[model samples]
Target: MGAWSRLKEAFTREANISSPEDLLAQARGMRNGKVPVTKDTALRNSAVWACLRLRADLMSSFPIDVYRYVNGIQIEVPKPPVLVSPGGTEVGMREWMYSTEFDLDRGGNCFGVITERSGVIGPDGRGLPGRIELVELGAVAIRGNGSTITKFIINGAEYDPWEVWHEKQYTVAGVPLGLSPVAYAAWVIEETLSAQQFARDWFAGGAVPLAELKNNAKVVNAKDARVARDQFRAAVDDSGLFVHGMDWEYKPIQAVASQSAFIEARQYGASEIARFFGCPGDLIDVAVSGSSITYASMTQRNLQFLIMNLGPAVGRREDAFSRRLVSGPRFVKFNTDALLRMDPEARARTIGARITNRTLAPSEARALDNLPPFTEDQLSEFDRLFGSRSVPAQPTTAVPGATP
Candidate 1:
């Protein structure tokens, strides 16, 4: 057939046409539509398909688990909660939860909360209870001010920070506590996370690879560096429980760092809470002096808050938890023998002190460092290796395990 006839046939062919004319016309149409089907596009499409096919392999290259989000950024898997006592056998909840916040300054060290909450059974199943409302607890507001009531979703779980506060305001007893939608969403995600044997499983499904290349090199590079910087900065920034900065807020990658840093800080902070609040030196002294330990109720309440943050809602331990109340400074005790063995001078100061305040002085902070303990030299070495100018100190009123 002639070129024109072939072209016509290709354009209106009932059967699928394989003519070169058809290819040319198709190209023209694509061009008119502002689509560039260049070699780069082909190569990018091929690469993306290949990566999607071998995502598990690529993820396995890293030391930790990596998750790719809607935005083309990868975040690490959040740290799983560490269970107490039976250790790996029991699933202990995390002591503190971290989240992002909007800082008006929009620069270094943004505002966020390290929250503590407790679970109690009312008419319904075990639910979070008391002045321990989710709203009053420290968390970033998604839609309103810090004080405003709103819903927040973290890792797919939905929670209403307001509902908890409302219950508190009304003093509604046995309100049959329920997880907010955000919390419920998070609960689903958590269940999925738990069921998956490997982190790569999350991205294993039907994510279509893009055929056209959109060169997001700048955004991708910026995100990677920003995330790295946030993680590094959190290690350095000594402001709150989880050190975060707003200089480059929610840069996608930073979310990963923020989640991770917050989890770690809260985990480490739990022991400190146990030492400071669980068993304050003053309380110990009072009990030893043959006086009624009046702080017992306070201790139970504090422990209730701490345990709520870390304990499972229903289980073998549930009844034990409900039967006994939380109180005292939930401070994890240090072994004096171990301290003395580690540092004679630090030990001497620890032992020589006529009274232990449970309140840590700047110098004596090292005393309680016994549980997962670090010595002065170790802390110094950490600072040197990590290039940190300051050491983390707990708030005096925090009572170790209390959510600060």
Candidate 2:
């Protein structure tokens, strides 16, 4: 096909998701003619952005490691240049992971153009993505059936499956495209956004539903009432007080309730957003209600978060990185210990316990504290202070019918 034909085809192709419906159909109650929930629009909702931000920050904080198993022990493998700089730019893997993770958290998918491939090939003769050039989700058009991607059209340029790097979450069994959280949860997000916008407009336009100056005791003529109304409105418009006589009373109908309900809706929406992102409401300051539960310390809270909220997502990322970044038995993993690090006193206690249990060594524990190995003088001091611990050998048992 000609360039124009390819461009037209790229623009005309149907959406990548299954069920073959309009992207915003699930959000039928969306305002302004049921507008679609793009990433930009969804991000305008603070709660949505907060959830995505929380996930992205945590995921990016982890350092990725490539290792191989030897006799069931993980042996650290030197990271290739590609792993260090996946973008083929000065941008390191951490920034790349952050951006891609943010995209995945918001849209359930991330796409990038492969700028270079390594000589080390993976399965199916497709080389590892040596350098990926990240692309905006808006600029990439995925053409495929529900289960498998056929071709990628990025900015009207065609690319094979191996030429692009795609990481997806919220996946279904038969769908090629990941189900977007923003799309599926659009109803809640749009409702929250609409409420926020309404509040802004209400304040900006100075439109009150209950601004009538009612006479409590005395009856006022229509002319006087109109005069009073005009005066009150003019004063309010000028950012002044609506001064009136004691006989007149101004009552608001559900005005306070309306504001309170909006606040409540925001809190509820925040909780829902935290849920959708698999985060603890408290972690994102969503303020869970009426709970007596408490953690002993921040470490416990982080432990709970790692176990219940972030573990599975981290595992999925490890799987993706293992499959795409390397071939053979070598795999990728995130150093999860960073998330569960304890305070200094607690850390010393834990490390001491491990040393007592013989599961850890003094040199290794020193490494955990970023300390160099003990010098001869330091070792002599320790040996002097605490007597040298010499192991006692067990008595040998002579075999009855065999030579000892």
Candidate 3:
């Protein structure tokens, strides 16, 4: 098949399900007095969106490398073209990782079709994919008999397991599918969305009157009451003064305390969503009450974030990539050293310290900054400025007043 044909086969918009059912259910009325919560509806909530986006954003930033073991040693190799442009030449590695990571973060799984394969075949009787095109989560369905997925249905077309690329997280025993944190946190999301809608509607003419105008002297006739109501509404709507004679009373209304706290409730909901997604509340910009963490430097902060929040997910993705994208002892690794990179001043201090202690060579340190090793003339100038690195005479002559 041509590349265009393969691309066509690789991606389809057909979904295993439709989204309007949730929308209709919500529109007709509440389901059991609560808004229906689905992936689509849940994303409308800012907290959920932020939590998922934060993870995907960070996941895509880490560069991936290919490595293989040789004689008890691991060495990095040039990454395959598929890793550089999985979706297409038009889609770079960062975009591909971002798209898949977004799906994995939101749904606990990511699905793609292997559109092309290499000429070399591995022991598994299948070649590594040369191209993989992801489709919408809605476009795929899983068929399993409890223990493992038996079939993959993409765009209403069935395919063998080998043709599909699937990665799953948040898994449990005896279940082929990943358990979605979004699905499990539906109640919190729904409550948050509902609160947002309530506040929106209240501001948009859904609340009780601001004040009631009443006459104490006499009961007004319907004709006069209608005229008076219109006059009052028209005056207030224009923010004009409502002039009235004696015997008229305007009683202002005050909202109950509960109704005025949805803003705070939304903040709390953000913290909850962050927790559900295993994201540090601070990393995702959701503040946890009575919790404060301090770090000495950016490297330390990023290290903590990687270890606590992103380490497991990164490891899981690395495993998936190694299993599916390569063969034999070859493996995939994410370059998290980029995350620990410090500012120039601090980096210089660190490398200088390492070189002084002989833990690292000056040439190796220069390479870390993408610089070539010092030339002979530069080395001679360095020797003059800061004494030679050659060891001092082994104190063959003991210190004048020291014990032997």
Candidate 4:
């Protein structure tokens, strides 16, 4: 066909296409209307940093323990080789958890590779994994149907779903892919960045001072104007002084709004980011005013945070670790009590109450405090101090002396 004829035919074919595949193709070719926010841009906002860092630090620092079920009771067990030291590096369990949580919170997913080696068998004769290597989320890709991951592509190598450890949050469209909070809250982030940039430029340009050169005869040329502008800049550049030639007037430009306005805008953005992450604004140093709610102590606030905000994320991590790292009745859990650590006085009261109510033994309470169990002598001493007192005969004589 002739070139023009071929082009005409292409247009006709495109006009007639009406398949689902065609629609998908068109959608893929088009750009999304929303502002695009990458991980770097999202982290530029202080609020995003506070929200993500707070959660990552808390989640990672919380103590994690592996337990085995014996006779319907859970007993703490030694951490597996995989859990004690992951990624085949010096990264400990806490650091690994922090990185995983940070990746999930920022990018919506985290990936790791399980390494196996020969001649490294457990007592049961099963080969234990040599190491677990964390992979950057950007370097990993997923291929599967809507419901499950069929394969993972990591650093140019393909892996089976079972060979890769994956954790994700808030899947989209029945797929296990996670949706990043940065992508959803891009508009706010953009506004915050713009406001900050404006403030920075305002201060950087000598606070936007203006120069007015009065030519009485109105005969100044472009050269004169250029010269005047250069002279003004040179004087004010780091000197904070402006000198002009004859008939020139210098007037500082007043800002349309005060610096506090921009400050408030940035503060609002921080709160919004915290809200998006379901974190408390006050925890991130965002001021809260005119509020009736009050926490008598930090413990109460932390308890509220755990119960309302961080609890679900912790539970999700525990479930993921338990399923991926253990077999049968063995499980993994984060000891959330670590986050609720109390002052010595409060801890004493709590443990004392538990011991008094018989819900917790003295030895168990001591162990919880990282103290060694009591010996026989110490146990006898505790019994002497707290044991019940015997009733004396004076009580009988108090009954009106009738039974003397």
Model 3, 1-404: lDDT tens per residue?
53223222222332332222232333334452557776667889877888788878888888898888788877777787888889887888898888887777777778899999987575568888989989888788765543555678899898877889888887755445565676667767877988988877666647556567899999999998899989988998898888888968988766566475987888878888888887778876776788667899989988988898889999998998888787778899998776788888898888778868877665566566565566666667767878984422222222221110
Q: How close is candidate 1 to the true structure, as a TM-score?
A: 0.17
Q: Which stretches of candidate 1 lie over 4 Å from their true place?
A: 1-141, 145-147, 155-158, 162-342, 349-404
The alpha-carbon lDDT assigned to residue 162 of candidate 2 equals: 83
Off by over 4 Å in 4: 1-36, 117-130, 206-223, 233-246, 256-258, 373-404
For candidate 3, the C-alpha RMSD (Å) to the true structure equals 9.7
lDDT of 1 by residue, 150-191 (tens): 444333344564332221111112211111211112222222
lDDT of each: 0.29, 0.73, 0.73, 0.69
The most accurate candidate by TM-score is: 3
lDDT digits (tens) for residues 1-404 of candidate 4? 43223323333331321211122224335322333356666788888988899999999888778888789867878777678777656878888889999888877778888776324443345554556788876677665543456778787788987677778885544435565676556667877887877777787875454334455646778998888787767877869786545667655666657678888888888878888777888898998767679888788999999999999999988888676566567788887877887888987888788767867665566556555555656656656887933211122112110100
Task: Give the per-residue lDDT digits (tens) of candidate 2, residues 170-276.
Answer: 87555565657776676677678877877886766555554456888878998988888888889989987777677788875556778899999988888887777
- TM-score of every model versus the real structure: 0.17, 0.81, 0.82, 0.77
